[model samples]
Target chain A: MSLLAAGGLAVGYRRGRRAPLTLVADVDLSLAAGELVCLVGPNGAGKSTLLRTLAGLQRPLAGRVTLAGADLHAMDARERAQRLATVWTGPVEVGLMAARELVALGRHPHTGWSGRLRAADEAAIDAALAAVDAAELAWQPVDQLSDGQRQKINIARALAQEPQLLLLDEPAAWLDLARRAEIMALLQRLARQQGCAVLLSSHDLELALRHADRLWLMSGDGTLRAGAPEDLALGGALSTAFRSAGLHYDALEGKFVSLQPRSGGPTVALHGSGTAASWTRRALERGGYRVCEPGCERAARAAVKVLQQGWELRLGSSRRRCESLESLLSALAAAPVD
Target chain B: MIRAQWRWPGATLLPGRLHSDPLQRQRLRRALLQGGLLCLVLALFLLSLMLGSVNIPPDEVLRSLSRAGAGESAWERIVLLIRLPKALTALLAGAALGVSGLLMQTLFRNPLAGPYVLGISSGASLGVALVLLGAGGTLGVTLVAGLGLGGSLALAGAAMTGAALVLLLVLLVARAVGSNMTLLVLGVMLGFLTSALVSMLLYFSVPEQVQAYVNWSFGSFGTVSWRELRVMAPLLLAGLTLAALLAKPLDALLPGEQVAQGLGLNVRRARLQVMLATAVLAGTVTAFCGPVGFLGIAVPHLCRSLAGTSCHRTLLPACMLCGAALALVAALVAELPGSNLVLPLNAVMALLGAPVVIHVLLRRRNLRRVFAS
Candidate 1:
């Protein structure tokens, strides 16, 4: 079942005596239960605005946002909060609260007068902590936790709410490569385990592409496209929105390839595969040599053979067997230009 | 270290007893500490009553307190008219200033935020100045008692009105302003504006009127007679109660306003409520006791460090008790035993308060990050 569905949505701000400025217009998206969706865009691309709109943190300018079958804007904040939870990086004036206390705050909507925690609240908090792999951090102070640990705790806090939908704004924006992958994987597992739809915005496109169930590609033109990650990758939608100078989508690698194509340079034919050929092609491309396909599909002044035997460079009538790609490139450099 | 984790026992988590130790221990320790602090507050209350210039024998002071005699009885008059009210005034004023400071610091998320830092008292001063000087009189009423119950009541009322107006203006401006430094700077500027207006009033009024205003600005707890205490206590308690009620959202706020809002707290309403509580707490105290400095800014920080957590749940109550204790100590020191000379309350507070504020600023590595953003 769809937990949140936005149709004909528009989001932005209206300043004093000015017309409302839309950031994301006509955004149509639906998040089903247990789906992990990633929203990726450059700065000021309205990724946050879209997340805020979907989470009911901000009102849609012209569309209806239904959360758990109710109009998001029409519901009271507390009522909406019970069904939705959001996490983001901002200044937190954390007093002496432990990690558990932070997570317990997720139970705010369920808490009664004075916010006293009942048995169910405690059980939910504990289970949420366990879900996010943050159970061990329960007693530690929140401010003292590392960045990755903090993000995990943040997710646990949201999960503790037992909401039908979860929205996080860049939960892992400040971690190392390995940690980012871990956080992404954690979110993916959490969405499935808790059966709650999870949506997050992040600058790390690679991780999002690998782990997200769906992708919401927000562009600078205030438009967004939502589709399965593989479908977006296959349809060339990922590269279209992220394209910039010297950057193109590498269809083979499913990642953006930033290369300075050397125009009018003597080209060489790549005669191998695997890591050796790919790296050699990269090295040749970096040295201003265009590496053509093997069998010389196009005109080639040189053929660089990279095999288990060694790198064999045949430049016109002069053939040089070099020990490595470095020697081959150097040998190619010494070859007479046409 | 004082982050007391008192868990409500009725709630049991999965693997039920795994997390019970810290919660139960912290709760037990918190109870003991709070109880001990309560005892300390009472002891200081009694000490404040006993150690004054007259040095009335403790027994006589107790006797006079318990049973009143003739009109000419000096001990009875001293204990009843002077010490008891003064001590109570110190407790209420200190708690009020401390909690008010906590609210401002939490609301703005700035370490330097407080009633004094925000120029709240100066606004109160401006109010009193209007009543004393701008009222077109050679001599007029102030918060201190030169007149009867009616006069003191009128003075308090004027001061509260002035404070509320200034507080209203500050809260309105704070919503529009995002950065903590900008708000603090705005408060200082507002303080300056009120002070400037007050100076103009002083220039036009008689020296006797100016003198009354000056004494009022000097800051005093002893000036509040039993009658004025009646006016300040209920309001101070009410403000303190409001602060306690706000502790949860204030904790939610620790992660910042946006997160609090995400957690379902109405940030705008919560912010306004906090400001209202501060205005009432600071306004009433300033009206009754003048603008006592430093306690409002310093006490909250002091309590936070001692409690080892910023959770308003324990911190708010801790701040109140700690503030009461500090005020009593300050009151005792100002009394100057064995000498009839009483130190100016404002000067004493500044001397004590300035150090704490400076210490906190020095200790924080990211001063600019906390306020400038």
Candidate 2:
């Protein structure tokens, strides 16, 4: 079933007599149950704002968000809460509650006005904790946990709600590389196993590309592009979304690489393939020499050169002498004053 | 570790495992234990009524209780009239302050946020100062005392107004600065400003009026008349009931306002309701009991420590009961070594409450670890 549908959505914020900051513009998207989508965008690209609006945390300046054919705007807060759960970034202060107790708060909607946890509620909490591998930490205080562990507990808390849709704003912001992977894997598992429609905003483009079932690309110009990860990557959307000055995408390598400057120095031959040329090129640059055609002049008197897998040095009116890069550096430093 | 194993009746135990089922059972047991604590507090409240100045036997106390006018002696009249009202007022006032503190702390997402932290009590003090010191006469004194109660209530209204004003400021600042700590410091500064204004009013008052104000400031439950109780009781009950109704939303709020809104609570309305409830509670208690200190800030933390949970479902009631118990105990102690020499209830509460506040601060590191994200 289609869990959420946003039609002709537009969001903007007005700041004290200034022009409105337009975030999302005329976006249409539909998310189905058991689908995991990652929203990737640069800072201030409106990913967080879109997620908040979808979760009903923020009202859209103009848009219609419907869950299961019912307009979200028409639903009361409590009714909307029954279908959606969110895990927001930043510290949560709930006094001295234990992890399990915190997770049980997810059952607020299902529980009675008194908020008594039934046996079914207890089972759900246990299942959620166990699903997130946080069962052992249930009795531990939430404030005592590591950041990564706390993030997992928060996810577990959301899972305990058993909502149809889950929205997370930068859930992996504080996690290390390994923990980040673990959290992504956990989210994927939740989407598959629990049949939840999950949408999370993250800055980890590479990880999101690898793990997310679909990608929602929020551009700097207030537009959203949604498609499969491979489709986006192949279509150049990924590169375009993250483009900045001096950084170019390598389609074959699937990563960014810095363009190397040409070397300029005295005529010298170098014999090396990939590794040797790369290392020597780096060394020459560090020594303030640039690589160029052999006959090119304008090389400084102090410039060092490498040719045919060997270093060459030519002082004023002196013949070029071959030496290792280390010896060449030492020779330049130790040379007699002219 | 004391790994005490408590078995629920007719439940099968799985050997060599953590017994996940047992954990659920343990929670149920813990809830029952909290219930027992509440019952124990009720018993203590009854016991408090029996101990007093005159050597009226327990039987005579019970007899006086069973029949209203049968024991029309001065001793019975004093016990029924004076001490009972005072003790009950202390209980209600303390409970109100405790709930107010809990609500404020939860709403602001700060452990230190309370009636005093928000300057609500100080606002009440300012109102009392205007009544007692601003205008001076014996007739003015009677009028101020009457108006003082109403003025203190107005002070509470003013406090709510101040809180709303500050909330607007904080929200604007939060958008501009995007810093939580700065907003907290701003609240503290607002509170300081109100207190400074109250002190200025106190400085210009006449000595006799100052003495009366000072006595009220010391905090006592002995001043509530039956008539005042009639007004105070319903207000406290109604405010507390409203607060209790907010428990679920308030629990969502603890995670932060944004989270609460995402959970489908109108954060603005919830916050306003909480502020109004807290103002009514703290204001009414201060009006009747003369700005009693510490209970509004301390009891919530004490309940959290005892119950090991922050879910308002348990924390609200636990705080209410514990606050009443603490106040009742304090009242009993105030009346001890003979009821004639009553110590100010505020002094006793401070002696008890200050250490708990310091302890919460000292153990904040551990608390942060427990709730860290």
Candidate 3:
């Protein structure tokens, strides 16, 4: 069931024959068919290194990576490419090669030495383009593509490879928020429909958590943790890997937010439900107030209540009613501490 | 909109799709371009034969070309024995250099790269310098006697050896260094080292020997006699064949070696083949034509810009024809058609090619599109 398996793998650059400078040590990972696994980590957490090692672009410092139960490194590029395809981050230098031509390169393992694209190859390229939602870009020069468009084409190129296991390194690193989510969703659909395992590394935690069937968490300490996305998020593994001193993972929100920084300021209990409470919490946090007891109106010590009318601040004998979130923040700021 | 029209050659014209007959259209268009360029090459070839120290009429030139069994006239002897070989030499040299430059440019992914970017010309000069200046009295290859049997053969042989050695060094460095830029810089450094060695040889040689080396350095297409063409033609053909075979892999390489390897190419093997191809094309041309300049570096760029695409399938043949056409033009310019005096070949090439290079540098078109993905 495992399309790709990396067992006790150590990734690093080698210096002659002595030993390699191992960056990620003893990584045990497996990708099954028809699955989407996203690799997430902080900067310099060896995500690219682990991905590169799995892709067979670099020699692992230790251990073995097998594709279809055979040693990955031992296979020729053509044979390896047939089983495992990787899409690296772009801007890929291209000399006016059409997006379709770029995708057709994926047929190298299937085509003859002359690299003439056949009818089947053309079909695969068209299917790939359509799959990645880049059908219109098929005839455009890859050199002239926008970054987001280029990333879509890169995915299409990998799809055209027709590999059982697809790996990508930061495929949407440069896209805007909406495009990032779209790319992740596209990768998930590609895995499900194409019946190929797709493994990609990304720093977009929200998109990764929302779309990825499973998660591989690479930490700064060179440890790789893998589990279902929700399991990993709730299990505190994602937070441990990515959340630094100033950042904290909000499990309910499935996103990261700034840690309150423990300012010795007075605590304010903001009480509300839905978007109002969330925005009030954000404003209180931004206003330098330690917003505690969220949605707990009865907590007593100076608390603000969010009624349909507005924000009613009750500060020991001094009550202020404000309508807008800005006025409420101002009142909260100008109000005396209990 | 412009990008769409430009990429029509590679558009995915799937069967029964809206886009129709791209392969057929591409072939027809390519045929037309090739026909036009081939005609130009022939016209220039004829012009090359007709205009020289002694002018021959077009009718006479054709008469001699067609009726070979007739009594050889002064014009026939001149056209057949002298002009025909020189023009063929220029044509072959130009084609070889053009393809070689295209390969080098693709290999290095640098536009400034040419056949001599790898110190091949300097190596050939080093070879000729060693024979002419270092061992002048023994070899006895005089500037006037350069076209003679013993001297010309020895000079060409020495030049080829020197070129082979430099090519071998470059290929060696290319194998060791992973980066194309590093290999390219190493080539330039190798040129400097060889040039320094040649300067030392020049300082110690006699005046007559120095004069001979200087004249050889001036560069010429007419240096290849009929005997040399027999050797140069086959070698250039082999190089051209290698370039054609490498078209697909080289297309994968336009993005660079990493992508080529990703496309299931054996990068090391492809690079070795490219180097071998360049060594043959560049080395043979340098041996026969004294390092014909500009055609190698400029012709491919001219063809690529005109063709509006960098598909090696189209651009390779285009480079060949453009290279031949440009070389013939350069040959004509060097001949100074009306006057008996001939200009130094490099001088004319510089006058023509330097502007194009400067223009490309100034215009800076499609550079980042090729560099940044």
Candidate 4:
């Protein structure tokens, strides 16, 4: 079984002569075969560092990483290459190379001393291009591709390695929304069809949550939380991990939503049930107004709720005209404080 | 499905289409073609020995070859003493420099990088200058010139040292400057600085010493003696072999350092090997020939264009053949009978190389567009 595991992994960098700024602290994670994991974090939360370390491009100051029962640090470069493949977000400067040639580079570990690609190597390259839907662009120079298309080709190159563990650093960073979905779908499909353990870092939390089999959430407080996406989302770990103040975690929608303030002045006769009215009442309060029930003196001065058209302003209500929910709130704020 | 099979010739099989797979067949065909070309180069090299200032009849040349002293007096001396050794030196040096230039270009990932561009030639010049200028008076002119023998060896060592130093600096600068063009400019500046130092030495040296230095700088294949060839030949062979061995790893490096490393090549070791091989090849040729120009830089580009692929497997041997042929042609032109005074080899190369370089630069855009199309 192919498995990727990291234990007590600590990564840090020194800016100058001062104490080192820790990026990932005592993190432990494991990904099994046929599993796809998405790593999400805020800026400077060590997501990229973690990916780099796992890819063997960066050495961890402490702790160890292992791939499929092999110690990553101890394996020879060729053996390690045969087991793992990584794609980073950087421009490969050899501009005129064809897409197929780029993918064939993945077979470097398998080729002999002469590096003559065999028939099997060619077949593997073709399979990789097809897997990523890049077969049509095989003969085209990668420089000619759009950013999104190039990203797919890069992924195809990694896939051609036929590695058990695939690590990608921000694969979706340059892609548009639809292309991003397509790439994510491809990654998921690869994990399932080929039984490759895939781990990718991304800023697109909603897509990651929806698609990934597992999530590694790097909390702002130097902690890494790992579980199924739904488990972490239900545990209040995602909202806390993202720490976006303007957003609230919606259990029903299984996503974050922007809490917009109610606009109309605090003049309304509430006739709805507790659930709807409570939400409306909370929204109104957050918009800076007092909620009044039906037939109170404050409610009398406020507007009456019409059958189909919602609320309209009545008598003296703080010199505010309640036209719609949005305008009324601004009007109330503009009125003289009496 | 039929269209797909035809479009991707190697990917899928077409019914009743019995052609051998093109890519594999083409690779074999190219291999055979390169082998044939190498044989042709050998034959032409032997033929060059027959055509020189004093044209020896092919039959007489063969007679002299069978028994050194049996042919006509002048023909015997010419074939034995002059033509054979000179042709051999030219072929070996050409092959070495061609391979050297190819290695440096691939390692640096720059089309312009070569022995001359990286200041290895300048280091050799410095060694020659020390021997020619510093030791000229105490040691007579011939003795001082003979010091060139030792001077060249030392120069090869020094050039290797200089190459390593520049390589280290480029690697360091590469970290700071993200652009390949910037690294190329830095390498060129290094070359200029070394050349400037050589020029200052030239200005201060005596007239006799200056003449000796000038001859050395003009470069010739006739300078390597039988004794020197014993030492030089093996070194050139070894260096070229090392470069050929590095073909696969070098191709991997073309994409980028990270990708190459990920492909399981020890990037640091591979780079060092390439640098050392280039130094030996360039250093030996420069020591013997007085810093031959254009062959090392332009020959690889010519091979790449002809082969239509940057894959080192084809490019390296192609470069070696092309370089040997070009150098032999230059040597032949220099030895033309009308000019009893031999033309400098570098001047002949510039006549051929400069125009190609200009043409490459002029048509670069159109070429790239055509390749893309």
Candidate 5:
């Protein structure tokens, strides 16, 4: 059985004395135990709305959400909090709170009226901090933490809640590439090891594709397409969902494909393979050079060969060995534009 | 490797938990500070009793306090009849305002929020103006008299009713206003509106009634008699009890309203409880003490900075203790100790309170740490 399931749910906001605005509707989603799902969409495509609806923070306009065979919305807040937790993208304002104290707050539902942490609650907090590799930061004030550390501490706080289902709205929205990947990996590990269902919305499609167990892709038209990452890519759902005039999804490469418009004056026959060759292609493209294929290489005005140590630039029978991509670009610039 | 243990301010090393637990160390330090403040409050309370317009010796003051119906000497009469009630009134008012201020700050998530800052005091003053100035005449008089109350009791009832009404209005407006800055500005505007109404009422009153209103507006703890304490103490105690019960909800609300709700806190009900506590505390104090300023806004900040934590469980008690101490100090200073000349209570409070506020603001980082922006 799924940990949480939503069927025929419609989410929207009501204005004063008017019809409610429906941002998304007719959605069916389920999160299974120990499964990690990534909710991916463009900005303002109702990702947060759907996440809020699933978490039971907001009432659904149409249908019901069930958790463990019971209606999620019908449960009291404390009961729901015991079963599920949510983390938001907005920065938390915690004044003079240490990392441990903040994480311990996630045990809110389990604690008594005074919120005194029992021994069990303390153990949970310690385990959560260790889970996020943030035990060293337990004593540090939250305001003094780096952005990456703060995000980890936030995740730890949610973990301390000991929920069967966790929902996060864009938890990795503001982080460096390394930190973003680390967070994704951590979430994946937590879901597997703790047998907790994890669902998070993220704009980092590349990381989502690589690390997410399954994908719930919400397109610009407010329709959700859920499947395995590779299956979605192979079915052309990713391409259609993220379609733009200037870009297309590269299925084989598992990334977006777009090139700068050629300068229309300089044409270069570039030859290479591997990482260096791909980077050189990007540099040449950025420099507004038209890189020719095998058929057009012999007829090109400028030909560049990717060698073992350096780039060999040949322009009209004159050869120059450029040490780097920067030098190669400058050499092309110095060459006559014809 | 040997672990380094540096001492936090005022922290005493307690066995079992004090070795490496920073949380326990913080608790110990807060306890030390509270203990010191309790001593200071006692010392100041004794000083307030001993050094009034007529100076009574410490032994004499203690004798008068310990022995009921002691010899009817001038010193005993001064200590028992006059200064004891005044000192008790200061302590109660200070504590009420402090806790009220903390609640307002947390409810709105604005550091500058207080009963006076949010115009709740002005609402009370407006109620008193209607009664004392006879602007409402038979309507206000009959309203209080109908309840079998007279004199200060009528003023207390009218003031509390006005405060509750204004607080109700503010809470309604708080729902509509999203920004804390906007809510504070609206509160200031409400203050201005109520004060203007008060001024208009004062304009039409007779000279004798106007003098009574003016004297009350100067803000004094000495005006509350032993009879009034009967009414004031229970109301303030009830407010304090209610605030203590809300400590967990207030801590949960520190993150934001939505986050608090997600934490299983009933945000709306908690908010109403907080407002109710604020109204009772601020209104009862204002009705008796005449809109005493600075203690409400300043005491909470003092407690936060001294304790270095915003956890309401710690803060509520700290505010109570620190607030009582500060008010006693202000009352003692306003008494002018040796001389018969007395300074205005509000003037003394401003002289003591404004510097603390300025110091908090100028530090910038402390201000950031106190408020949830």
Candidate 6:
């Protein structure tokens, strides 16, 4: 059975006594144990509303959300918290509390009213710290730590809950490239080792594609397309979902191509096959040159040979060895176009 | 030379471990600090009892306190009748305001939030102002002469009602407002509205009534009698107990309300309980002590700095001990032992509290990160 399942789920907000405006509806989503899913979407695409609803933080406008085969909304807050934990993107004010103390608070559902951690609770906190590789940070004050270190503690706090399902809302939003990749890898490892389902909304589409086992792509028309990242890319679902003027998703490169191919531009015949050849092709294309293969019969303004040492530009029998791509572009500009 | 290491049997994670844990060491230090604060409170309590207009000796104060009715001497009356109740009132009221201030700060997640910031004290003052200034010509002059047990109860009851009403309004606004900052602004507006009503009442009232109101507004810990203490003590104790019991939720709230909810705390219910606790505490002290200032806003910041941790389990008790000590010191200073003149309680509190808060702010650069955001 799936760890979490939601069918016909609708989520949005209500204003006054008027009709509730549904941002997205008829959503069917499920997460199996040990699976990592990433929710990808544009702004105002109801990713937050959907994530909040699935986590039982907010009521779903339409249908049922079940966690481990039990109705999520029917359970008391503590019962639901014991099974599911959420990590948010917002910065937390931990005041003067130590990292271990903050992590121990995740035992709120298991402990008594005083939230005193027992022996079992202490072991869980230790395991959480170790899982996040943050044992060294356990004694440090949370406010004193850097943002990435604090985010590790935040994830550790959630892990201490010992939940079967974890939901994170753009947990890597504010982090830089290395830190963002670290968090994504950590979540993936947690799901694999602990056999808990991990689902997170992310604005970093490339990271999501690289790390997620499956992607839930939300379109502007309030539709969702879920499949393997490569499958979605190959099926053109990613491009269709994020369709905007002059924006295209390149499947081979696994990136969004926003620069359109220029029309009726100067032509260049590119030669050689290696990393240098591929990069030279890119630079030539970006420089508004129509780069042709080595054997194109079309009339060419300039012919370029990518040598082992440097780029050799032959403009009407005037050969010039360009040392760099910058110099090559500048040399190409200096060459006269007939 | 080998050093002998002390360890609790069956307590160490490893049987041969020699070093103690950092958390354990921190707990020990806080425990010692709290003990010191308790001693300070007791010493200040003694000082408050001993030093007044006509200075009474410690032995006389203790004798009067221990063995009641042993003698009807003037010293005994001064210690038993006047100073004892005044000191007890300061201790209880100060502790109450301190805990309430902590609750308000946590609930709103703002360092500037307190009973005064939320207009709770202003509500109490408006209630008292109505009784003393608006209806003074008919009712207050007589009530003022002998604010005996019954008349003081009436004032306390009125103050509680007014505070409850304002708290209800704030809670309603809290529900509608999107952020803590908005709720704080609305609370300040409510305070302004209540004070405006009070000023208008003062404008229309007789000069005698206006003087009565002004005297009440200066605030006094000495006005509470033995009878009033009987009423005030139970209410203040109950509020403090509630605040202590709420330490877990308040600590969870340090990260903000959404995370507190994620931790399985019933955020709405906890908020209601917190505001109710604040109302009971701030209301009771304002009733008998006449809107004592600075203690509510200052004591929590002082205790937070002294304790050096945001965990309210330690902070609540520390606030109670430190608040009682600070209030006793202020009360003693206001007494002006050698002189016949008594300084106003609020003036002494401002003189004492402002510097401690300023110093704490200057020393702790992370105060903004801890509370403002």
Highest lDDT model number: 6
Predicted chain B of candidate 6, TM-score versus the true chain B? 0.90
User: How many collisions per candidate?
Assistant: 6, 21, 2, 3, 0, 0
For candidate 1, write residues B65-170 as lDDT tens digits: 7785546488788888899999999998888888999988888787768866566777888888888887766337443345435665677778888888888888
Per-candidate TM-score against the hidden true structure: 0.87, 0.79, 0.89, 0.78, 0.92, 0.92
Query: Which regions in candidate 2 have their CA more than 4 angstroms from the true location?
Result: A1-3, A91-93, A258-338, B1-20, B23-25, B32-36, B50-55, B68-70, B142-197, B356-373
lDDT of 5 by residue, A265-313 (tens): 5678888788998899889988877788645766687888899999999
Candidate 2 — what's its lDDT? 0.74
True interface contacts retained by model 4: 0.48
DockQ of each two-chain model: 0.49, 0.41, 0.55, 0.29, 0.69, 0.70
What lDDT tens digits, residue by residue, belong to model 1 across residues A1-338? 68788888889986769899889888777999999999987688888878887777777789899987889989888887888899885434355668898898888878864778899999999999999888899999776787788788888888888889989898877788888899899989988887889999998888998999989888778888889888888898877877753467787888877755647777788888988888988899888887789777359988988769778887777777888777887888887777
- Fnat for model 1? 0.59
What is the Cα-based TM-score of model 2?
0.79
Clashing pairs in 5: none
Colliding residue pairs in candidate 4: A263-A325, A263-A326, A264-A325
Estimate every model's Cα lDDT from 0 to 1.
0.80, 0.74, 0.82, 0.74, 0.84, 0.85
TM-score result, candidate 5: 0.92
In candidate 4, residue B86 scores what lDDT?
Answer: 81
Stretches off by above 4 angstroms in model 3 are A25-27, A243-246, A258-260, A266-277, A292-338, B1-31, B136-148, B354-364, B371-373
Q: In candidate 1 chain A, what residue range of length 10 has the lowest lDDT sum?
A: A89-98
Candidates 3 and 4, the one with greater TM-score: 3
Please tell me which model should have the higher lDDT, number 2 or number 6.
Answer: 6
Which ranges of candidate 1 are over 4 A from the true structure?
A: A90-95, A244-246, A259-284, A292-338, B1-20, B68-73, B116-119, B141-152, B171-186, B204-208, B353-373
**Candidate 6, B195: how far from true, in Å?**
1.2
Is candidate 1 or 4 superior in lDDT?
1
